[model samples]
Target chain A: MAAPESGDGNNGAARMVTLISSDNTRFEVEAAAASLSQTLQLTILDGGGGGGDGIPLPNVDSATLSKVLEYCIKHAPAAANGGAPNATAVDRAELERFDNEFVNIDQSVLYSLIMAAHNLEIEGLQSLVAKKVADMIKGKSPMEIRRTLGFPDPTPEEQAEMNAHMLEYGWAYE
Target chain B: MAELLRQEAVEKVAEIEAQDSEGVHQEDRLSELPDDILMCILDRLAVLRDVARTSVLSKRWRHVVGLLTEITLSAADFESPVNGSKPTFDVVVQSNMDMVKAVTSILAHTSRRTIELLSLRFYLRDESIDIFRSVDHTMQNREVVKASFAVFPEMRDMVCTDDDMVIYGRRFLSFFYNYPRVFGGLKFLYISCVRLGKFDIANIFSTSIELEYLCLNNCDCGIRSLLQIEHPQLMGLKIICCAFEKVELNWLPKLQLWTYDSWMNSEDRYPLSFGYVPQPCNLRLINTGTTLHKTIKLSDFLDNAIIRQLNLDFQSGSVGDLKTRK
Candidate 1:
């Protein structure tokens, strides 16, 4: 059995740091905990930022990373648990409840989760957050949509282009 | 809860619209990413319509449907033709042909870096249909077995028609073996409600090695082996509305879920005979007593395999598809 790459920094037990972005703030986290992101997972594995080193995630901030860590800590096994129990009905329901509660933040936090989950490669988090984002897109007018997404007022050309598509898809305009 | 969900939905809609107007450009954003990311995104999409419509997003999305290695569209989907009059059916058929043309063009464009999924549902013969031969001939000859094609055979489900039921020849069945080889790696094949002979289906089943799940809905090939299925990596098998006189259940070595919903209301109770049962299948759902009876015959052979769970929802409409509470 190979030793996990984190304890005592031996037998590839080397540690590293992950810099997350939340409110433009950064916090360094353990490499193993941070490895949960697929984007970062490969970079870390490729030795870009292993051995207790620093890897800056300029996109993620401290607040969102803190929330991501909470979710990952609950879900990430030591790789010893062999990838989160195969999702039995009860466990699935429990996880659902946890997810429902976890995403209960303002639109700002939800957006951060989406980008962070994408960057980190937390598949479950990505799905949950993507679904959360997709859910928000449902049943809203154009003005309401513009307001919720925090997009600045669209220029005339941008508005025309956007309207053309929204009308074409008939999801947003109608 | 519903109101909260609705309100949240309204708020989220507003957000996506705002984002679409600003941060995201009108051109391809995520679609331009590598095929792997595209596949991941497609995996989350529930139906084939979502895949078809992805192309409407931008040029990069133009060929995403073909890039999909495995595509499944419910025969019940709206794009599926509904029975109607000659002109109406012709118009619908033309429109359907157009959609298929568009999809196939997409398939041609993508060349399927990963895989290609093509599924079609045609309206059955009705009194309103034109009762012609050229269209029927074209429908009978062309096929969409593989993901990509050149001499692209027009695809049409063959069945008996009221006006011209004379030319119900078996020539169309020969094309089964010629299923487009381009999609040799296609992971799933689902053909429902079409009347295909059992032997032809067996030939088709025997040929595709990459198929992971095979479903035959309402299509009867007589009493024979529905799946001489040698899909070693196959995981799921669903057969509904298919009538098999005496179908053998052999060759599924690694199947997880095998569901046969042929709800027959007969006093015989045990209508089917099992020759060799595929064991190791963990979840078996039996609503019809006849199928259970057939399964029971293989008890000795299946003894080595222990099913972790057996779901027998046998009631009056025991074989009913539990799609809704009603």
Candidate 2:
């Protein structure tokens, strides 16, 4: 990749940053998109992720980092507009469509993205993934939720506790 | 002992982390997530019952229930009788009571965390008093930043007589009087199908000091009664299908949007007049039910007020008959 230009002072080109995953893979992206993460915003603001140096995220792996970056790139424009209060209906609808399709992935990938999002402190991505997981388990019984989330079969003690909880709060179950 | 259990959980999670590399049987990874991540997931499950059920997922998830900052309990969450079958009075009462019991049980786990939002939508009934008291108690202990309420009468608007609506309004006022702090802290409130008196309506506005948005659907005072609105923090107001003779927008400093739909009087060209509204930007006047034969003048209706965006929908296709000033 070419070295990012700096000190030119507003040459009308968007400044870029490099983010290194835990596996030491470098991915180049715009500073605005990477700044969507509260954790990365300060570093990007301080001119740390340009040129030869890159922000290394130790907790996020390569595959998950790519997925997280995709969300940040898509949401950066709207976020730059202070949530785009004056955005057209079509623009808002397109973002909604993109978000709904973005989180449609395998459970394992979804869990990885959730953790990466949590570690990176991306508020929008975190809420999107959490809403996806919540939709998966909404209106299900305790046992049903465990199975849906791929939890192992409850032990006898756990089963007894679940039963006791159900007995005490029968209204919730109903 | 609590520390020991946490240590055991961490060790168990570490073991699971090791197994994740094998590429076989990727179950139970969700439980291994940290408490904050788990709390984030549970926050979207606004229904407190669903959040409560997560406690049985494992020992670690039991405390996550208390950390939830947004809670919504609606009577519609409980199953009602079939549509064709007319539910008896007792069935309706029982359903309301069950919803209240669920709400009470959920509130029992308040960890004194600051709640960002607490919204409740329930049928107007005696059991609703229990919900009011529980929410008041929750407010007293914790700081609820934004609270919203949508109250509905047991009888539908079409079936209810004027007397029934008056009684429901009285019950709502009584609840408001009893829990003044809860109403005072509300940022958004929606009331439907209630016939409130002139003073009763004004009293609600006085107590709901922090209100930003207020929606009144299928509600009104007496026939063609002049109702005046004055609030300090209200930004949006919607009046839908109400039987008010005239509505006077009196002294709303922060009002930005007002939507008036289908007033009772068809003979009166304008059903609303403005007073001391400094910042209204959007005004929507919709009349989809009937046609106005007289030519409605927008200049006279708006008087000297300058609105940025005005939407007039006379679904009867009479936009041409309406007059506007240059």
Candidate 3:
């Protein structure tokens, strides 16, 4: 494990790192922003992913990497402040607005984002996407949740089992 | 640029739906996710029953629901069936029995995991002992950070019968006294409608070192005794509609908020007293009775403490009476 960063003293001299997605697309991001991912933070602290050498993320696609980077950059400053005790109400509200808008994507993209966030071990992005998926499945029945997640329709045997369980625990389905 | 991005996302979803309609390939991507991610989604559900229902989705979800760390069980989740209009006495009893069985099953399954929050609210009856024992046994080895156990006995003839109330109270007192270890990790506790004596209350405050919030509503304390609450980590205390001769706060170093809301008919002016609250506090007093002496007593108490905010609501007396008394 890498030692945690001490403070934001070297904010102006923050280094930049390159990330190579699985499809061979190169993107440059600040070291502070990319460090939001625990996996990337350890490698970057060990003097890795510097000039001419980019971290390869074979599990994440180009589209999902950009979305994940967008979240990391937006949240990097607050993360550096260590929760920002002196943050004004307006500042906190603005970050909350950004989070709410960030997760408002299509179901397929949201699924991909959940995977990328998990693979990178980014805490905030993982929680945001999980909460979005949970909200999508919140008050719906089992069939509704299955359909919303794009699972194929239940087979005859599976449907019979669901009917029996629904009959047993009727309150949950209601 | 945002519009173009939205259009692309919408088209991607449309493509997935188009592929989903064809019967060639079918994938349960949600179920195929890692256990930790699925557990994250399961933990966000507000009700435990909803989590239990996920088992019917597929075989993979059966074991995932058992990994949740929070459990909330309520009486409304197990209401009895009605016969034409009203449920018979036997039906009600059977419903309570079924609820106890359900709770026992859940506890037996989740006994190995560390529970962060466990809330159980049910009407007290003969079957309540089983429910309480199941909870105690399950939480014995687990670290439950927050726990609430409330028992509201059913009222007969528009009044809560004293015999039933005493039975429920004694049950609660014995449960806590027998298993003092359960209180060692609680951070928030909300208890209502249970009878507690001086020893029971003191035992809880002394054992629960992490207790930060305590709410006692419609409780019966021992008669003619001062209910002294002395806890080191207690931050907020609220007492509503509870009967006691007096309440003395002692040694609560971190006490920041204290609220007492009730109608007092006591002759003693000072029914509540502060002993060693050094921090700036937010105090709220809502007395509905027209006792001028009580108002004067509260004013005197306020004169001694460092009150950051005071919210006082009296029904019968005016502020002028309090001023004149002062």
Candidate 4:
């Protein structure tokens, strides 16, 4: 496999490789993509072996990781395209559209995205998904937020305390 | 039978559309989220006043606003301060003060644990001396009444700037004392003020053990220990136009990123520490009118941050270790 050419100044020349998760799962991606995570970059650099032999990701499951890769794949385009060239209104609109569509998925898919982004250190993807959740959460009722996010119902005493705390968050929906 | 079948099919379609996804994992859900994600979500969160209004509806999100590490207050967020001199700005000083008071009161009740980042951006038209005074007053009254010590364990970046009186010399000392642990673990902190005392530097910096990116903007600070970096995990530090008798670089064991500029002569220049991490995170130093008499010794090892570039600018000839500025 060809070592990926990193036009960006930061990571230098990184190679494309195959990564294997715990359940014999495999992902063929550019080394630059894996290097999005500082932890993986350092580990690969410090290890100093071709290790092109599919780096094993025992902690990550296949389904969750594929979702993370979807985020990574979408983000890979933005990264390759030079990430929001000149922050113009139209450019921002395009990015906003991309971000919205990128994160619009089942709650379970969103959850997996959040977790995998964290594990993989895809900061942009994580933020997009989080802002998506936050947007849905804002102006929503606690029960509604809980229901939307799949959180379990609160105990009675917990509810009372929560009600008291809610008195402090100043905004409301009519 | 045919009519019943049609109704059943439509009802089934309705149920599928109405179904929500609510069975996802919760533990480590927030913690495992990337830092930027947390920042974005917190960014969208409403003010404490707005958040409290939600408590009447349900229990889960009542304290969620309080749990947020980012607290932002716009001048428009509050009514003008009570009985204050009319400041000469679109944002009334009274409004700024009221917002500060309301935020501090909420901070008073917010959880002291795991509160890592606190950002206060004020459009102040007045000197921020009283804003600090009120915080001091809160500290004094803390023991007598309900008080919780602020433990910002995960605080990284703090931006306290804009039109205001809060960014002053002695004030940051109080800020340092009130939240010593916060700065100790920070990655980026930017503060702008008029003056900086010798004691504030000697005392406040003693507690910043793991600072990474630091920028001091136009503060008339003493330069006695301008490079007294003790941070074990520090990666970057930026100091601009500050007073310094000598530049002393000591024991920055893991420091990889450094930005320092001092106009004072070599007599005031402090020596660079030895055997510190040869790894270069990112190092940028600017020479004002004055140049270094000698290239103070850097530990024998080359900076090994595996960096793609090195930017160093000086007068006349180039130092062997320093690369081009461009």
For this target, which candidate reaches the highest lDDT against the unseen true structure? 2
Docking class of 2: acceptable
Ranking according to lDDT, highest score first: 2, 3, 4, 1
lDDT per residue for candidate 3 within A11-102, as digits (tens), equals 55567778887679998988888888876776777666778877777667788889999999898888877766767888899999999999
* Span of ten consecutive residues with least summed lDDT in model 3 chain B: B13-22
Model 4: CA > 4 A from native: A1-14, A44-52, A80-82, A86-96, A168-174, B1-40, B46-70, B74-101, B110-134, B137-326
lDDT tens digits, residues A72-157, model 2? 88988788767879688999999999999999898888888887777677999999999999998799998898888877898899
- The alpha-carbon lDDT assigned to residue B260 of candidate 1 equals 63
Q: Compared with the true structure, what per-residue lDDT tens digits does model 3 show for residues B1-326?
A: 43343233233323322222123322455655678888888877776766767767886776676666888887656664454555445655656666676576567654367777777776567676777677778766666667766555544312545455466678777666666665666667776666666777788788888888888866666444568888999999998877766778867889999998873446554668778888888988787866444435445655456678878887866443332121
DockQ of each: 0.04, 0.25, 0.16, 0.11
Ten-residue region with minimum lDDT total, candidate 2 chain B: B12-21
Which consecutive 10 residues in model 4 chain A have the weakest lDDT in total? A165-174
RMSD of each: 12.8, 8.2, 8.7, 15.1
- Best-matching candidate per DockQ: 2
Per-prediction TM-score to the true structure, in the order listed: 0.49, 0.69, 0.70, 0.44
Prediction 1 TM-score vs. true:
0.49
Interface RMSD of each: 14.2, 8.6, 10.1, 16.6
Better of 1 and 3 by TM-score: 3
- The fraction of correct interface contacts reproduced by each prediction comes to 0.00, 0.48, 0.31, 0.24
**Single-chain TM-score of chain A, each candidate:** 0.63, 0.90, 0.89, 0.72
Give candidate 4's error at residue B108 in angstroms.
1.2
